[model samples]
Target chain A: MIELFNVSVQENKRLILNQVSLRINKGEFVYLIGKTGAGKTTLLRLIYLDLYPSQGNIIVENYSSATIKRRQIPYLRRKVGVVFQDFKLLPDRNVYENVAFALRVIGASRREIKSRVLSVLTQVGLNHKRYHLPHTLSGGEKQRVAIARALVNEPFILLADEPTGNLDPEASRDILELLEDINRSGTAVCMATHNYELIKLIPHRTILLDNGEIRREFSPAEVQQLKVIE
Target chain B: MSVFFLLKEGIVGLKRARLAAVITIVSICLSLSLFGSFTLVGYNLQDVFNRFYKKIRLEVFLDSSLGLDQLEKLKKKIHQNPEVEAVEYISSQAALQEFQKTFGQDLSSVLKSNPLPASFRVVLRPKYTAPERIEDLANRIRRLPGVQEVLYQKEIVRFLHKYLGLGIAILLIFAFLILVVITILIFNTIRLTIHSRMNIIEIMQLVGATNLFIKSPYIIEGMLQGLLGSLLAVGILALFVSFIRDVFYHGIQVPPHLYPFLLILGTLLGLLGSYISVNKYLKY
Candidate 1:
């Protein structure tokens, strides 16, 4: 669903990602494990077309970084949902409005917005607190709301950048389970996190990045061995 | 996106920043009202000047020894000029009679003989009433045979002519300044609103909203501000007009379409200001 051809991103003469190549197949749930400043977020940003590659091209679904028009970025974004560590919900809006906003921007009909927002909220187990404002929600509830917002448009892929960074251990496990459920339901998910411990909890495939370069790929059993080493 | 959704978002934006919206609207209202008042003053002042110009006439005095046939020929010649609207002959006896009537004294009784010269009162066409044009015509008339002198209110005409142009120029400068100030105020207000909602804009972009989708609400907000501000300005101008009529002159003439023109101008200015600001912010 997502492929990068030796992509490189730079900022003010500093290389953020250098000659990085990877492919994420359909319905794959992959964990990007790296330390701070390891180019995990930069990789996800390239996939969403938020920042162009400095040296190479990326193909996400049908959009290409080399030939995509500036105007087409929004349409590309609609097909790929992203969640941030901060949740990025509009503080003044309630849970339902925050999720419905995603559909509204796509000019979804009023009836369709309500229906899809409710359905996604139900999936994320946030339907009961739909009217509660962001400030009133707990950290885990907030991330769930963000997930519902990302899923409201039924995107083909989900990119998460440290989505559970602010959550407690229990909450992080719940979010991980939710992501797994989403991946099993046939939407690819690429989650970038520095938490090696979480990878061992329920691992499918893990790519270890170090200093802007991919070091190794680990399967479920290898992730267990790494957990044993730690 | 639906027009209704865009409009709702606009109203929601205004509601979100009530104080800023009110300040912008008031700024537009006061500036437009001032401009409208100046426009009305210029309009009425032109009317007064036109009425005054219609009454001005050139007095072409003839030599006292000119014969009756020569006087008639001179009158015909002067009347044939394209600039001359009409020419009325006034003999010395008639001139004396008019002087006596105006001064309320018998001028012939005091002079022992009719000393006034016969003259033709020449009324020029409206377009030829400028001070310089009148001077040119007078110079032409002075070269005619049997012509003694051509008299006009030269000093008064020159004063009004020079000052009227300066007055209009000053008025135009002030109107332009007000327009600029209002535009900047609207622009900055919209800019501030966009700055406060920068996060929302980013989120909208991430959620696949087009540039037009993000900008439509701000544009609509600006237009609404303009419409309301202009309506207030028109109301204030109406009150000013009535006040002037009641306290100063009852014959003040206002253009029938002044209010509508001001309303449309205010609305368009708002639109322009908001459009530029949003486009700059979006870089679209």
Candidate 2:
């Protein structure tokens, strides 16, 4: 769960998020919709403690920005999974090693790493392509590998920043379904995307961000009429 | 947390940046070998200066009228001085023989009798062989009983006192500059290596890898490269030392401790360079 109260983020005298207050309960899948520079990425970064709020604090799980020490950021990060549009995978490593990297960095044992990596790869439907490198995989498969890596540690929440940006329509739909499947299994997901059509495909609770502020909140029924205030 | 994992990562890092690692190691090897060679030269140069200092002799000439008893007493008094390491008495007859051997001419052919005076050749302790100290001892000896004159190589001592100090100062400054240059070169090389792998490091950071977890492998790679390069340097220096001993001077000795010293220095340099680079990158 994540809670941000009166949070404002400013960098170089430019406000990215201003006085934004929101709360995400456990096991909820929330879609954060905004145009480019609408502060969607900044909000996610604040939740992960990658960027600090200029005016207020953020609480992600048990770690609070007001009290978290520098040494404790890694522990906070381990609990919050983040995926990017670029699907930042090591180019030289295969899909299996890429997924196992998450466990290896935290000093997981060989047996635990193997089991968890295989399970996650199987969950993401990429187990058959475990030995393939990132460049050889399609966009959807690459994002699946990234998701497997993010989920290897069994994080409490997953933050997806434009996860389907590079994929085609069918592939994007597949990735969205996979994310929904992950959410139903109990990990809270806060996904940021600009494509309003994806929300119509499988409607969920959506939040609209405009000009560094939350413009509106829409229920699953309201998702059909959702429109970006461009 | 596993030491083996860290070691394997370090090896993998080196393999991943094969050309960069090789360039770094070769640069370190060449620079360290040059440094080692310079140190050996400085050591041997000091030895040569020491030999030259030992050759400085203070001669105390005696009056011709002095008898055997007076000469013996004078010899005992001069030898008792703390600065004096040895005193050899050259009789007038021995002086005449020495003069004849040097010029290949008998004293009888040049004069009616031996013109050379009996003297005590005084060898000073190594610590007391400075030009000013030698001159002071000469002045004191000149005031002694039955001592007519005292003589030493004034010009040679003066040259050593002035030029030798200047030479050593220049050498020390040069050595310090070389040390700074080598450190910068190695530091930049390691920085470039880290720069090339910035994406990997960024991925590691994003995946919740602790700073220690990210930095350990790069640091180990640096240390391994340093140790390897310095070992090659030490081997090169050993060969150079042996060649100098055989072809030039047998007295040129490689101190038993220098091998380990160079190895430790090189390793420390690598550690320091890599640690700074990683820490700076991680700060972002």
Candidate 3:
């Protein structure tokens, strides 16, 4: 579970997120919808403690931002997986190494790394692309590899920052579907995106963010109605 | 497991950044060479002083008009001094013989009479070889009855002792400066080399890699560069010593332990350089 208590993040005297309070429970799939510079990525970064909260406290699993030491940030990150929009895979490493890298950093055993990497690769349908470099993989497969890397450690939450930003429409659909599958398997996923159309596929909860604040929350029927009305 | 990966990555990093790695190794080589050459010169100078310190002796020239009993008494008195280790009485005739043996011309033939003075060649105890101590012993011997003058190599010892100390002090300063320059060179080299991999670093951090995990590879990379550079320096120095044997006389007196000392020093410097660069560059 993740909790942000009136969190405010600043970027050089400019307020990015102002008094934003958000909570994500286990197994919940929440969509963070906002326009460019609407503080969507900043919110996700705050959750991962990449950008510290300027004026509030955030609790990710057991680590409280108010009291967590600088050294404990990495351990906090291990429990919350982050998937960047660019897929940020090590260009030199193959798909297998890229995925296993997540587990490797957490000091996972060699046998655990091998087995878990394979299992997660299978889940993301990237088992066949093992040993293939990042440049060789398709956009869809690259996103899948990133997802597998995020999931290999079996984190409690997956903070996806535009997981399908660079993908084509068809590829985006596959990634969204894979995320839904992951959420169903009891892993909390907070996916940030501007694509309203993708919100209709599995609309559990969609939190609309505008000017660093949540404007509204929509249920599955409301998302469907909004899609129909639009 | 982490160590294995770190070492592998360190070797891999060298191959990946060949130019930076080469620059680091070359910089370390030059720095250590400067250090090694200074050490060689310093030790050789000390060797010169040690050679003369062992051979130092006072020539106690006796008065030409002294009676046989007075000469014997002077020799006995000089030998009784605690500083005197051994003394051999050389009469004017024997002195002339030694002079002829050394110069290949008998002093008796050169002059109407054997003019070389009778003296006692007084070898002092090793502890009295110090300039001040030897001066004190010489003064004591000069006061003996029928003794004309007490002579020892004071000027050469003063010159050697003065410059040897100054040379060691200067070398220490040079070593300190060299260490600083080498550390900075290595820090920049490794920092520049690893900067391009910031993306990988951030990704690793996002994936929960600890600071130690991120830093291990860079540390190991520094050590590798140091090891290679020092070995190259020692090999070149040994080669130079082998080609020129007269400086060392018989064999190069560079201690066998110097190799390991350099290796360890290089490794420590590498670690320090990497630690500094990592602390500066890796913000996360």
Candidate 4:
């Protein structure tokens, strides 16, 4: 459902992503493994229509990312969900409002939004914390709240950038499991992370990036072999 | 999206930023009050000119040497002019009696004989009050045999006309400048307020919020500010008008009819200022 063809992204006169071609099919769970400044976030931004490629083309759900008008960007965004590394929750709002915000932007009816937000919050194990503000929640709880917000709209794909970057080991494992369950429910998930240890445990399709290029793709057996040493 | 939702969100935003909203509304009210006062001054000045112009009459002094036939012929000729609305002839005796009544015993002892001349008080049609028309009528009256001097308040009319034009021009300029300044002030306030909410805007943009969905609340808030500001301005102006009337009770002859005009102008100014400010800041 997402395709990139030789896409190059440049910011501040430096190439961030160099001739990167990648594809994730429908319902496929893919993990993008890369080091710092390896263009993982840039690639996700390109697919989400937040930033256009400096060169080459990107196709997300059959819509050309480069040619879409500014007004059409919101519609495209509704079809895809993005989870940021910082959680990006409004501090003044409670957990329920944070998730309901996603549906509100899409002009969902109040009844449907309430039901959907409650169900999604319950799914992410955040139903009891719905009335708590973002600052009052723990790091893991905030991440779960962000995940619930992303999934509340029932998007076709979920692009998460280090969803567990701030969480403890136990909390990180719970988030990863929740993401895996979401993927199994038929929404394609593409998560970018640098933690090879978590990758060893989860065992998904892995695309490894080094120095602005996808240098390796590991199958299940190869991934298992790579994890044997860890 | 339903208008009810838009309104609810707008009210919530206004409530969240109540102080800023009140500041904006008060600023608008102050500016519109000044505008309304200027408009009232302009309206009343026009009324004064209208009243003064309508009372103007032309006086034609008849020559003492003219015979009765010549006087009758002069009157007939003066009536033929389209500018003359009505012409009434006053004989020397009648003029003397009117002068005696005005000056009383002092005037009766000063003059043994009646020196007052028989005159024609000519009232012109309202359309003939222009400078050129009055001049034309005066010139025509001068040509009559029995007419000695044809006098009207031509200089006063010309002066009032010129000053009235200048007054209107100055008022319009002041109004335009006030509108510009109000727009800039309100725009600055809104820009600052929106800056405080920039993170909210960014978050909304990231979550697939359409521009309309995001901007509707701000626009509705603007409208509410405008409505409330104008209402306050009108109320304040009403109080000011009442105070002025009490202070100048019977001293200044301001017409009571101008209150409605002032209220309308104040409301319009408030609405316009809010609209200009909101439109400028809400654009992406």
Candidate number of the best DockQ: 1
Better of 3 and 4 by lDDT: 3
DockQ of 2: 0.66
lDDT of each: 0.88, 0.89, 0.83, 0.80
Please give me the DockQ of candidate 1 compared with the native complex: 0.72
iRMS for all predictions?
1.2, 1.4, 1.4, 1.6
lDDT of 2 by residue, B222-242 (tens): 998888889989999999989
| Residue-by-residue lDDT tens digits, candidate 2, A86-121 | 999999999999999888888999999999999999
Query: What is the DockQ for all candidates, taken in turn?
Result: 0.72, 0.66, 0.66, 0.59
lDDT of 1 by residue, B215-257 (tens): 9998999899889899999999999899989999998878789
Q: lDDT by residue for model 4 over B155-235, one digit each (tens)?
A: 897987788868977987897788778667766665565566666666677778887887777767766776677678778
> What TM value does model 3 have?
0.85
TM-score of 4: 0.83
lDDT of 1: 0.88
Better of 2 and 3 by TM-score: 2
List where candidate 1 sits over 4 angstroms from the true fold.
A224-230, B65-72, B80-82
User: Candidate 3, chain A: TM-score?
Assistant: 0.96
Clashes by residue pair, model 3: none
Query: What TM-score would every model get versus the actual structure?
Result: 0.91, 0.95, 0.85, 0.83
Q: Tell me the docking grade of candidate 4.
A: medium
How far off is residue B139 in model 3, in Å?
Answer: 5.0
Q: State the fnat of model 1.
A: 0.76
Ranking by DockQ: 1, 2, 3, 4
- Is 2 or 4 the stronger prediction by TM-score? 2
